[model samples]
Target: MSERKVRVIVAKPGLDGHDRGAKVVARALRDAGMEVIYTGLRQTPEQIVQTAIQEDADAIGISILSGAHEYYFGRIIELLKERKASDILVFGGGVIPEDDVPKLKAMGAGAIFGPGTPTSVCIDWLNSAVREKWARETA
Candidate 1:
């Protein structure tokens, strides 16, 4: 079988109208040869999860600047588990406080890219993480 490109769903969840960061990340991911499907602004956690599963995405990258990271991240992770889609890794970025990073990570977020983090950092981490996950599954 032919190898497929890594598919990622980049989303902006909740009523947060800020999307410049999300758009930037999506573009960066796409430029790095990943197939990116942007769920656009104000997407609910359910919608984002549904889109990811439907698109067979390897990961979901959420961007939230509305200070509702805890709810959105936790809910998405929970929903993925509930639907047996935990393999679709969840990661996020935004104005989250440093203290909450560990909590979100504990909730199964692969990584959290805070403000001013270089896109290359995210790109590299995602590539490595996806590669490792694929290896584990194949093994």
Candidate 2:
């Protein structure tokens, strides 16, 4: 049987108008054989989470370059938990500081990528993480 493609929701949470990086990662994931949904810019936490649920996404990749990574991600994860969709993997990228990485992960984010991190790194991690998430869910 053919394997199912991993579905990822790429979102720009908050007022961050710049989406070049998010777009790049979205395209890279699509090229990597995953189904990617790019939600454009200026999305709210509720919107992102709702879209993820509606899309039945296996993961959410949020790109925040406006220094509100903590707030946005925290709210998003909180909503996911409240809605009983916390199993959907949450990762983030874009202008994030190294020091804030641990905090974001502690807030239920799967991975946090700072500027200069390669797109391939994110893609590889997503492939492994998504598979592991599905495996755990099924088991």
- List the RMSD of every prediction in angstroms: 1.0, 0.9
TM-score of each: 0.97, 0.97
Residue runs of model 2 more than 4 Å from their true location after superposition: none
Q: What is the lDDT of residue 56 in candidate 1?
A: 91
Q: Per-residue lDDT for 50 in model 2?
A: 96
lDDT of 1 by residue, 1-45 (tens): 977789999999999899999999999999999999988888998
Residue 6 lDDT (model 1): 92
Output the lDDT of residue 39, model 2: 89
Model 2 clashing residue pairs (backbone): none
lDDT of 2 by residue, 50-82 (tens): 999999999999998899999999999999999
Q: How accurate is candidate 2 locally (lDDT)?
A: 0.93
